[model samples]
Target: MISAQNIIKTYGNKTKKTQILNNISLTIADRSFTVILGASGSGKSTLLNILSGLERPDSGSIRYADTDITFLSDSQLTEFRKEKIGFVFQQYYLLPNMTAEQNIRMGADLAGNPDYRETIRAVGLENERKKYPDELSGGEQQRVSIARALAKKPDFLFLDEPTGALDEKTGRQILAYIADIHQRCGVTMILVTHNQNIAEMADTVIRMNSGRIETEQKNQTKKTAYEIAW
Candidate 1:
């Protein structure tokens, strides 16, 4: 379980400080799909960064099981994230010169996961393995990015608007792949997005407003990616 207590994050100096998260506390169950839903400037992204250890909270404790990551130094946190977390963002961030398979191999190499080809098959990118990022479609690029992250075999996968750059049809397809992978691998997936429809697919939906959590609901019946209205 990932537990966060009184998370308070602010930006800028004292004279111009802008609080991004305010006394937020939440718990994410292991192997569960979670969605943090909010509008622009609602602090959802900032909260995700803190929870995933990409950023430190000004005053709070973030614990992954029994380990309190908040106390870890910069280098320690870097190693921690390298070992335990995988991230997929709106941007593909793939090396232009590298083929899809090679890009995925970069992450797999980090954890010495030799069975990385399984991840390519998991994301349905088997045929596109040799294709460069420029040759692939937006949706395909995103799939490669997801596969790269998953190849690392991280316990937690943090996705920041994974489908933000894709069209409706492509987004649905990507979400389906993600859903399937989560079910098969049992990885803890935390997705941050502004779309309310996406929340229907998650086990837990957290709504944020301004700098606070407005509500956190557990869906009694989670909807599949295709079942949600785009």
Candidate 2:
């Protein structure tokens, strides 16, 4: 039940304000998969950060379940981020020194939760758990990142170009992994991708242009199984 109503976010001062978002409103249904599609610099990241409580809106309301996150103190936002949200970035932000297993465990440990060994195995990385980031391939690194995020058992997951660094074949496999995690975990997911091919696979595709949602499309006829379930 994450709904952002008429969310507005601007950067800079009044005299020279850059409107990053303009009256944007969207909702992430419980256990739904969504894709936010936009070109570079079209406010995609800004919108994602706002929803995840990493940034605040200038003139808008954001609600996650029962809490209104508009003016939450910095400390409160930090706690909320740690407890509620999981992030997967394009770069696969894993520590250089930590093994894949250690990194995955660390993410949950920070949030005061149990390490999710099953998710690690689900990502097909149980054998590589002892390997560090530098030792793994691009796709494997992404899997570790995904496993780490899922280890948090977050209420929602935000993935920014989850497959950006991998080859085409590897990217598709990564997407399948994401689909599997989403399905098995029953976690709400919002993926931001510049690839239109991937966007079409989402349950709902939110097209954006210049900081505004151009249109939204839903594929009611497409079976959920067709959505990249690996």
Return the top candidate by lDDT.
1
RMSD of each: 1.0, 2.5
- Candidate 2: tens digits of C-alpha lDDT, residues 32-130: 889999998889888998988888888788888889888789899888889989999899989999999999998878777775687787789989999
Q: Best candidate, TM-score-wise?
A: 1
Candidate 1: which stretches are off by over 4 Å? none
Q: Give the per-residue lDDT of model 1 (tens digit) for 1-230.
A: 99999999999986899999999999999999999999999999899999889999999999999899999999999999889999998888888999999999999998889998988988889999999999999999999999899999999999999999999999999999889989998999999999999999999999999999999999999888899999
- The alpha-carbon lDDT assigned to residue 93 of candidate 1 equals 89
TM-score of each: 0.97, 0.91
TM-score of 1: 0.97
- Pairs in steric clash, model 1: none
